[model samples]
Target: MGFELPDRSVLPRHPVIVGDEPRQSGSGAMFCHLYPANGQPTGEVAGAGAADVDAAVAAARAAQPAWRAMNGDARRDLLLRYAAVLKQHAQELAALETLGNGSPVMMAGYAPMVAAQRFEYYAGWADKLRGQTLSAWNNPAHNYVDYEPYGVVGAVIPWNGPVFAAAMLLAPVLAAGNCVVIKAPELAPYSVMRMGELFLEAGFPPGVVNMLAGGPEVGAAIVGHADVDKVAFIGSGGTARKVLQSAAENLTPCCLELGGKSAVIVFEDADLAQAGQMGLSGAISVSGQGCVNGTRVLVQRSIYDQYLAVMQQIAGHIPVGDPLDPGTVMGPVISEASVQRILGIVGKAREEGARVLTGGQRLDGEYADGFYLPLTIIADVDPASSLSRHEVFGPVLAVTPFDSEEEAIALANGTDYGLGAYIHTRDLRRAHSVANQMQAGMIHVNASGEGMQPFAPFGGMKQSGFGRLGGEQGLLEFLQTRNVWMNLKAPQ
Candidate 1:
C-alpha cells in the first residue's frame, strides 16, 4: 500500500535515528546535503557525536535480552510489518536518497524495493531457525546444539547504497533476534535517519534499533563500545582496516565489505551486446560509486574491438542530467571534490598511455558547478597501471584485452581485491573452469544485478572483506553456536 507523507512532498530533511525516534543531531555541526545535479544545498540533518554513540549502544544493550526473549513468531511478524512500512514509504525514501547522494530517483527506488523483499524473505526464516539434533552411540548420551544471537551489533553503512545496505546488514541480524546500533552513512545520513521512526511504527520495542549520524570518530566509538558484540562495515579498504584494528582491541567480530577493483571478463563466445550492457552497468551504474564496480574489464582479443565499439555506443547514450528527472539514466557523483578526483585519475591514465575512447573530462558549460562526470572508457590500459590496479570509485571504465583463457583468468584474479567479478561466456565448461579459479567471493556467471538475494551468500575474498551477509550464512553470522549435553537415565 502506498502511504502519503503527512509532511507533504518532503523528507524529514535533517533526520537522525536515536533509539526509536527521528531526533535532531546534537553533534553541534549541521550537515547540509547538496544536490549534485546543480550543486545546490537541498537539506540538512543532525550529525552524531561521541555521546550520541554511547547512548545508542547503551540503549541497544538494554533492549537485546527482551527482544531475544520474544518468541520467533513475534519477531517474524514485526519484521514483516517493517517491510510493509518500507514499501509504503519507498517513494519518500527514494527522493531523500536522490537529494542527498546524487543517485537517480529510479535507481534509489529500487534499493527500498529490494529492502522490503529481503525483509519478507528473512522474516520467513525467523520461526524456521533450526538446531542440530545429535545421535548417541549407545552410551546413554543426549546431545544437541542451538544458535543464539550476539547481544548488540554495531553496523557502519556506506553512502553509495543506503536502503539496500540496511536490508543486507540488518535483516539477518534482526532475524536472529539481535539488537543493533547503526553508524548511519555520514555522507548521506538523512533517509536512514528517517528510518528511526519506523521502528516503533512497525511495533518493534524501543531500543531494538538505533542509529547515529557521525563521521569516523563516531564509528570508532561504536567499535570500541564495550557493549557492542560485533561490527558490520561496508566502505573503502582503508576505512575497513581502521575498523578492523579498532574492533580488534575489544576482540569484537567484524564483517568487512570493503572496496574492490573487480574485473569483467568477456570471452570470445560471449554475446557482444550483453557484454556491453554488463560493461556499462559495472562502471556506469550508480556513477560507479559501488564497491564492486568492475571498472577494469578484460575482453578476449577476438571480441575485444567489437565489444569496445558496443561499449562506446552505450557510453554515448547514457543520459547525464538532473537526478530527479525520470529520463535520467546517470546522475552526478557524490560531490564536487569527487568530480575533481575522478578527473585526476583519468588524466593520470591518459598520461600513462591509455587512450580515451570517449569522454575523459567533467561536463563544463551547463554542468559547471555540479559534480558531473561524463561516461569515460579508457582503452588499452595496462594491467599493471594504476587505473587497473586501484579502485577509481567513479564513472571510469578501463579496458584491456587477453588472448587466451589462462590470460583471462590471470587478468581477472591479478588484483588485490576479491569482492566481485563478472564473466560473460556461452560454454559451460569454460564458465566453470574460469569461475573455479576466480578469486572473488561472488561471481556473476553470465548474469547481472549485483548477484544478491535474501538467501544467497554475498561477501568477498582477500582484502575486499570477509564474512557472509545473506541467507542462512548471513543468519549464522549474527549467531553463536552453543552445545547442550545430557545423560539419559536409561539406554533407549
Candidate 2:
C-alpha cells in the first residue's frame, strides 16, 4: 500500500519561481519527491539548475529596495498574516514533512507549530530593530550606527526539518529587511514551495520570497552570485566547507549551522525517573536525527550500573513503527541510504572494543519497507572511540562511566563538536557549576533538551559551525552595520 498524505488539496504545483512566476529547469527536468516511509512517489518539483537560481537571485535583487523601503510596521503586519496562515495549514505541512523524510507524524506536526511560533516571534521583532547613536563617544562629531539589510540572501535549508528550519531562517531574515531566494535541498523542496505560496497568499510582494529547487548546482548559483551578499546554509560538515569555499569566492559572508556530537551527563544525585525520561527523549528524538541531540551519555560511577539498566529498558521500550501511526514514537531514517550509514557506524563500533548493551540492527518483518531502527546503546565504550567522539545521527547512545566530576567533564567535552550539551542533577548548585563548565552553545540544566526559546540565540563553537540562528543575533545575521559620522563644526 502506498503512504498517504493527510491532505493533498493544499499541495503546491512544481517549477521554481522567479518574482511570483513559476518556470521549469533550463532543460525542463523535474525532481520527484519520494515517501521515505515506503519509497513511493509523493510529488514532483522542477529540478532547478543554475539558470533558475540566477533568475531567482536577479528577481530578489530587483525587489530588495521596494521591500526595504516598506515600513517595518507594514512588514510586521504582513509577516503576522503569514504566521496565521502557517498555523491554519499546519497539518498539511506536517503530512508533507512525514512524506518527505519519514519523520513520525507526531513529531512532524510539531514542525508546523514551531515554525508558526518562530514566525510570530520574528514578526514581533520587525519594528523593534534599532541602531546606536554614539555622539558622546566621538568628540566634535555626531556619530550614528545604522543596520542595513544585506540585500538578497541565499538560504540553502536542510532536509531534516525543512519547514521549521526554513521558517527559522526566513522569519528573521525577512524581518531584517532582506529579500531571500531559498534553495530547497535534495530531500525536501515541496513544503518550501508550498510555504512560498502561503507567503504570497499573505500578501508578501513578489520576488520578496522566492523558492528554488535542485541540488548543489542551484545552491552554488545562489551562494556564488555576485549580487547575493550573504548565504545561510544548514547541512553536513563536508557540505559546509564547500559552501564556505563558494562564499569565499564572492567574499560573501555566511551563517553555517552544521553537525553535533553532544553529550548528556547524569549525576548520581539526579532524579532517576526525570533523568531517564529526559535522557531517552534526547536519544530517540527524531530517531536521533537532530543536530543537537545528546548522543553521548556520561554517568557518575556511583550509580552507573543502575542508570545503565534504566537506559537499556528505555531503549528496549521505545516504539519503532509507521510514521503515520500516532502510537509510533520513532519512525524510519530519511532514506535507506541513511539507514545503511547509521548501521555501518554501529557495526564499526561493535568491531572496535565497544560492547552493545542492546539493539544494533534494523527492525524488519512488519517494518521491512521502511527504514526503522531501534534505539542502540553502546556501553563499556572508550570515550575517545569513533562511536563516542563522532556523530551517529541515529538512535544510538554511547554511554561512558566516569569516576569523578573532573572525569565526567573531560569525557563530556572530549569531542571536537560543542553544539549542545545536557546535565541532569537534583543539586541546584552542582547543576549550575557543571553547566558552567560544559562547553556548548546551548546547555540544558537538570534536564535534557529544554529551554530552546526564540528569544535566545542558538549556534555552536569550534567545528560545529559558527554564527547565530535565533533571537536578536539571528536578525543581525542578515544586516550590515554602517557608521555615519558628521563634524560638529564646519571644516576650514
Candidate 3:
C-alpha cells in the first residue's frame, strides 16, 4: 500500500530563526525545497544571506555571555526541557523530514527521538565538565586547569540527516556553555527550522540557538565571522576544505565531521549471512548518503563468491519506493542531480573494469520521475580506481577480493578516508588484531548496526577530517583550556 504525503500547509515559511523568533530573510531571497520522491516542490523557504548571517552571529554573540554565566545546573535544566519538547513534537518533525529529505518516514521518525536522547545524554555532562589539578615542580605554588567555552560557535550541518546532525552538534555545544549560530542545509530545512522554535518553547534565552537556512554563502559568512569564536561543520570533504579556507581568515578553530569511504572486511571463517546483511545495511542506510558508511567491502578469496551471492540476494529484496510508505525500506537519492552523479560514478567504475553484479540503472515506471536508484553491487572493484578512492555517497557497494590477511588490511585502509571500519570474523584474536590495525576512528568487530552513538566519540583521521562529535570528547570540542597558577608562599 502507498503512503500519503503530508499537506504543504505544515511546512515552515520563515526559515531564519534568531533571537527567539522566526523571521524572514533579510535579503528576501527564497528557494523551493523539492521532494526527492517525485521531484515536486515540497515548500518554499527564505534563503538566508550575508545580512541574515551577520544578524544571527550578532545575536549569538550578544547571548553568549549570559548563557556562559549561567551555572551548569541551570543550563542542564533548560536542555532537558528542550529535549522533552523535541520528543513531544517528534511526529511533526518526522513528517517534515520525510517531506524535505526522502528518507523513509519510518526511519526519519527515529531521528528526532534519537536527537532527544542525545540532548538528555549531554545534559548529564553539563555539570560534569571538570578540569585537572597539577603540581608545581619544586616550588611553593598551586596550579590547575579550567575548561571554558569558546563563547559563540558557528555550526553547519548537511542535508542527509539534518535533525540528528543538529542535535548532535547543539547538545554538546550548549552543554559546554556556548551559544551557536547554525546554518541548516537549504535542501532540507523544515525540521531544523522547527527545532529553532522548540528552543524558545523550552524557555531558552533569545538568540541562544539561532538557525539559518541557505546555501554556501551563508556558511562562509558564519565560518568567517570573527565573533563566532569557533566552528563545527558536517558535510562533504570538498565543502570542508572551503570551510577551512574561510575559517583560516579569522584563525578560528573548527571541528569538521566530513565524508568517508569506509571499509568492511570479511574473513573466511566469518558468518557469511550476518556479514552480508550487516555490510549491506551499512552501505545502504540513509540510502547510502551517510558519511561513514562501509561502502567498500573487502572479502577473503576463499569466501568471496559466497559473500557476493549473499549480498546480491539481500540487495534484490530491499524495497524501494515513496519514502512516506511505511513498507518502503529504501527511498530516492536527495535530488535528480544526486541520481545522475551516482549513475555517472557507477558507469565510470564499469569502464574501469568493475563488474556490475546487479542494479546499475535508474528505476523506470512509477519511480522514473523520482530520484530513485536501486541498491547496486559492483564486484571485482579495482582498489586503484576512482570508485574505490572517492566517496560515491549513494547506495553503491564496491566489492573487492584479497588473498592474505595483510592484503585485506591494506585494501581496507587503501582510501584516504578513516572514519569507520568493520571486521567480521569468528577468531577472537584475529578480530582484535585486524581491528587494531584498521586506520579508522571507530572499528566494529563481527558486528554492524546503527552508525553513531552519543556515548562514544565519532570522527575521522587523515582526509576524512578531524575532531569528534559524541560523548565527553565531543563536549570538549567546544571548550578551551585555561591554566591558573597561584603562589603559596608570601614574600616577607
lDDT of 3 by residue, 1-492 (tens): 343557877776667887876886546468888888888887677788888888888898899999999999999999899999999999999988888789998799999999999999999999888999998987789899999899989999999999999999999999999999998888888888888878888999998999888888888889999888998999999999998998999899999999888899999999999999998975568889998888999999999999999999988888888898888889989999999999999999988889999899999888888888989999999999998888998999999999999999998888899999999999999999998898899888876745578999999988889999998899999999999999898788
Name the runs in model 2 displaced over 4 angstroms: 1-10, 23-29, 490-492
* Worst window of 10 by summed lDDT in candidate 2: 1-10
Candidate 3 has its poorest 10 consecutive residues by lDDT at 1-10
Q: Predictions ranked by TM-score, top down?
A: 3, 2, 1
Worst window of 10 by summed lDDT in candidate 1: 1-10
- Candidate numbers sorted by lDDT from highest down: 3, 1, 2
| CA displacement after TM-score superposition, residue 76 of candidate 1 (Å) | 0.5
Better of 1 and 3 by TM-score: 3
Supply the TM-score for candidate 3.
0.98
Expressed as tens digits, the lDDT of each residue in 220-276 for candidate 2 is: 788888889889988778889888888899899999998998888989998887777
lDDT of 3 at 257: 90
